[model samples]
Target: MTANFSGDNSSTDLLIEHRREIADLLQRIKNRRLQVFGLYATPIALIVTLLAWAGSKIFIWLHGDTPTAVNSVFAAAVFILGVASVIQGLAEFGSGSPWEDSETSVRGLKLDLSLAEEKHVLEARRHTPPVSDRQASYKERIPGEIARLRKESRHYRRLHLLMQWLLFISSAAITAVTAWYDPPQPAKGALIGLGATVTIIAAAAGYFKPRERAFNLQQTADSIEQHTTALELGISPYSAAGEEENLKTYAATVEGLRAEQRMREQQLDQPQQGQQQVI
Candidate 1:
């Protein structure tokens, strides 16, 4: 049976607007973070480029071959441009991301939404008579939570696979490039640095262990699905003569699975270098 959760039109509209605003704000925050990261990375990129350029220049000097007028002018211009860019990036990066205001707003809106939702629920209960305890659960909670778990699992799975491929490809490229250029050229050094960047990223990914998160989430999702299907099919746990008892069992099992998944995620988030235990 479907659950009727709506209150009055106005309250329903307010809830909808609140959700829309929250989504928009979250998107804005994500975009802002990306922008800030780009700004912060710019100076590091400039330094790497300058280091490569200086190395190339040093190699030329060691050969006792002076640069042509045009080559010297070009190198000078490039160095000056790189330096200016580095300064600009450093200045902007020091200001850091302005996340405080937006995050504060998000928190305020969430609190308001919680209070409004509680009031809305009370209004709904007052207007519509008492409902079956399972009405909301059977109709909304199970499906929503299952969908969320599936989506989170997929997201983490994809991230883990992508990072795994990066680790593999970067290691291969580093070896291949080193063999390809026996000479110590700046270009080769820059390529090696790029490969090291991938290694660093892979190390960070390892620490986070998206694979474990995906495993735990998928396991929880599968568990929930299995119990749901058994409950619907009136199998062992649900075979009892009492419908309420079956529903209670299903609720308890699903909650337990969810709690376990949350704990697994927290353990994965710890700041350790060791392999995470996938529960």
Candidate 2:
């Protein structure tokens, strides 16, 4: 029941080469994106952690018997850095995840190419037609792919949003404890931890962009499912066409949707902020 991407007897080296080239390009792009993300996260996390841990000393330096205003200036710098990190983190988050997107593209391409090869084999074997079991294989396979995509999309979406909400609640709790409750030294430490956590979460969320990823995945999956349904029903493109022709049409439609998804991911990779960052 497995479909091989290695083409049928007529497949040319040029075609296989082209597909490999595309896959390689996608992998490179994904690697570059992950590097960029790591570059952004590392320094931000380190500096923020340092500032949070030194909260007690900084507070003492700012408020205690220090005649000079140097501590005030230093504290301001830390605050600025923290804010900047949050902004950058969020920017990176919405910029899209090249790794997952690339994986999706490469996966779809392989499946599409394998299906194409399968069609060729079936066409060639017309004189000695395959069994009904062979025909049933593809019918079962397409839905399985659709289900996998949907499940993965939902998993990321839910995990990210859940984390974001939890951080927000933690932030709220810290703000409330410090502003209204007049906490002691131990409680004050919690405020510093809160600031660090929020900054990290903000940056992480920006980079992760779970909601958009999930939405795009769901859309692509739904589009493919629709086409599958149409072909099964013998609709316009699928009707009056031979099995091979119908499959080509289906592959074309699915590929188009996947291309759209790629374009959308590219657009997201840019530094978008303000209202655009909400989702």
Candidate 3:
């Protein structure tokens, strides 16, 4: 019964099939990157918080009182634990795209195809899902696209702020601690964790570049809105006599912008892409 419903794919069908897979793989790669970052970042954040709590307690205990043998013991313990945690984080999460190599290899597998390999793969890929016939009109979808892009823009903007502020606060804390006074041994050991925190945070920032994402998303949304407005007003290129043609123009422009936005995001997610200046 299953075989009866399935049709063998020709070269053309295989081309379409591979193209769709590539697009889906690209999206999955981005998702994988985010998941890996969160996986490492969450624990690192907890470690940082714990270090701050420990440091605060140490400071409060030492503020006016003369440093005692007991205080040194406690500080040493905190220093050992905090520094270990931070080093672990830097080792694991210090930021080029994690898990990206596997995905890239998968993509390479897809690209390095042969006629024989394609045939073998096609034998298993014959089961194609039915494409949906019902679709939302541009009128129904454009507003939603505009809204989504704007919302994502805001989300990335907030992320940018959070990462930036964390880096700033970490840097200032490190500097202030160094300049304030000569620290006794235990406190100095604990402060090393703060420095490591800054390294991890900077690595995350450079890799993610959330500011670039926010800007690109907002730019795409704005361009889409501009096209939408022009289309509705029937002005210039959209001034075609037929409303259908005007709508077509708007759809093309909006989709092109959306595609560009997705490309920009892919660039942001790739560490090597960071070397190139973002558009």
Best by the TM-score measure: 1
Q: Which residue window of length 10 is worst by lDDT in model 1?
A: 97-106
| Residue 81 miss distance in model 2 (angstroms) | 44
RMSD of each: 10.7, 16.0, 15.2
Candidate 1 per-residue C-alpha lDDT over 147-254 given as tens digits, one digit per residue, 9 for 90 to 100? 899899999899998888888877777777777877647457767686887978788787878888888988888889888889889997779988777887777777
| Candidates 1 and 3 compared by TM-score, better number | 1
TM-score of each: 0.55, 0.47, 0.49
Candidate 2, residue 106: the lDDT equals: 40
- Backbone clashes (count) for model 1: 0
Looking at candidate 3, the ten consecutive residues that score lowest on lDDT are 127-136
- Among the numbered candidates, top lDDT falls to 1
Candidate 3: residue 138 lDDT (0-100): 57
- How many clashes show up per model? 0, 4, 0
Give the higher-lDDT candidate: 2 or 3. 3
Q: Score candidate 3 by lDDT.
A: 0.68
C-alpha positional error of residue 12 in candidate 2 after TM-score superposition, expressed in Å: 19
